[model samples]
Target: MSSDVLVCQGISKSYGEGEQKEQVLSRVDLTFQKGQASVLIGPSGSGKTTLLSILGCLLAPSEGELIINSEAVNFKDKSSLTEVRRLKLGFIFQHAQLLPFLTIKENLVVFARNTGMQADDIEQRIQLLIERLQLVAMAPKFPSQLSGGQRQRVAIARALLHRPSIVLADEPTAALDWHNGQTVVELLLDQARVEQAVLVVVTHDVRMLPLFDRILAIENGIVQVKQNVK
Candidate 1:
């Protein structure tokens, strides 16, 4: 089987119409293979988030195709797009975004159940991730009761609980201290590799760039490969 898990072909995104149209992305072609972790860096308004949104299936590109696991995405079909996102993609954000009322384990369980994971399977996955992330004690605590780093660790576990083929993180360490940020990124990379998932992270931290297998930079609506370790 092909190692390629996520691909963007001639992808472009624009806003408004005709004379008022503003292009955000231009022919953004990218292919992410299994077990590869890539970090995207760019100036503010350089379309980094726009491209990530398209990759996450949260937004449709004006022109071009997004292929996930060799299947072309039908952006026009809302149900199909929903299915794609639910089944093939995992996401982490700047904030942990955990439910205030639910405990850590509850949060993970809810998401896994939504993805159709069986009760026994969900329990096993949750146990494994909780231990791997060192979130065992926090599992019974609510999000508000945990530290920022602890919360983000739970977020990582939540994202990987379903074992999605593609994992996308948007400035996941933006709110943490240097030590915590580094730890979070390291854990994310290690877990993604263990899951053999395609990992894509958007960040502005130059220090974190070298941790990824590949570095992609965006400028003036274009994406260029900055570094590749593999």
Candidate 2:
């Protein structure tokens, strides 16, 4: 472990106002160091996903400050938040969310291209990710041709292709069976360690707990840390 990659101080989130108000998260503080992988688990509607979203910079916290790479980000500024997300963070959702019209390899490259990356550099990164994620054989295939596990693997590859310093995965294996779900999580954990990325995953699957360096439980908007099989 090295310097803290992400830090949240007194983070809180709420929705609506007055009679329609909904409080999803209470004051929460967290720190994640490089190469650390954490799994956040909670019951349905327990605000685990909300916390994940705040951490990923997808949703601004109703209150508190977020420091990324030792700098406090102003979520109120869309451009600042967008730039931080683009340069430092990677996100994975429950669904693979691959582009149906493109080949597996193209799906990965298209995203890099959108960032105006050099064509040769993009190709090199794609091949590297494909090999690391063991997606070489499936590169030529389309999303529809892949199994659920395969697609999720590709999603993992796509999220990491940019070599992000922080990765936020929200229920990434929720769509797969036991075998495949475990496989996908294992791959994510392994890859995060290899890249020395700060990975935070939100999931209800307790089976994936042992693989994480730490586990956090959320309930009634409160966050509790649990020491795991690190």
Candidate 3:
């Protein structure tokens, strides 16, 4: 069986048209397989987040095919894309974005529920994830009650709560200090490995570059594989 989770062929992204057109990505070819941790590094306005968004199904690429878990994304069909985003993909943003009114466990459960997982199954998975994330004691607490690290952990737990096949993180550790940042990255790596999911992270923290399996440096919308420091 093929282990590939994501494949991008001749991927190009642009805005506007003709005279006003702006090309952000050009002929970017890439492949990400299960259990691989890939990091994207780039300068500001280098299309890192744009490419991530396109990969996450939040945005449509102007040209080329994006295959996720072997299913081609039909940009013309919003519902098809929504189904892919909901059932197969997971996203972790720089902010935890947990609802203030919901408890830590509740925040995670809501997603699983929305994804149509059964009640008992949801509970079972959330319990295990929160335990692994060490958020067991903090389950009943709200987002504001937890520290930055704790909140990011909860965010991670939430993202993985539904057991998606591919995980995309956008600057996940950008806000924390080194210690907390590394801790978050380690936890993400460990859980991603356990789940056998493809993990792609975007980061500006050069100090954490050595942790990823591969490094993709982007500048002016072009992606170049720098090195596999792992």
Question: What TM-score would each prediction reach against the true structure?
Answer: 0.98, 0.95, 0.97
Candidate 3 segments whose C-alpha is farther than 4 A from its true place: none
Question: Per-candidate RMSD vs. true structure?
Answer: 1.0, 1.5, 1.0
Candidate 2 clashes: the total is 0
Lowest lDDT 10-mer window, candidate 1? 221-230
Output the TM-score of candidate 2.
Answer: 0.95
Q: What is the lDDT of residue 56 in candidate 2?
A: 79
lDDT of 2 at 143: 97
Candidate 3 lDDT by residue in tens digits, 1-230: 78988999889999999999999999899999998989999999999999999899989888999998887889889999899989988888898778889998888888899899999999899989989999999999999999988999998888788888889999989889999999999999899999988989999999888988989899989999866745
Q: Write the per-residue lDDT of candidate 2 for residues 134-220, one digit (tens) a residue.
A: 899999999999999999999988778788899999899989999999999999999889889999999888888999999889998
Give the best candidate by lDDT. 1
lDDT of 1 by residue, 133-186 (tens): 999988889999998899989989988989999999999999999999999999
**Maximum-TM-score candidate:** 1
For residue 98, give model 1's deviation from the true position in Å: 0.8
TM accuracy, model 3: 0.97
User: Model-by-model lDDT, in order?
Assistant: 0.93, 0.89, 0.90
Q: Model 3: how far is 78 from its true place, Å?
A: 1.1
C-alpha RMSD of candidate 1: 1.0
Ten contiguous residues minimizing lDDT sum, candidate 3: 221-230
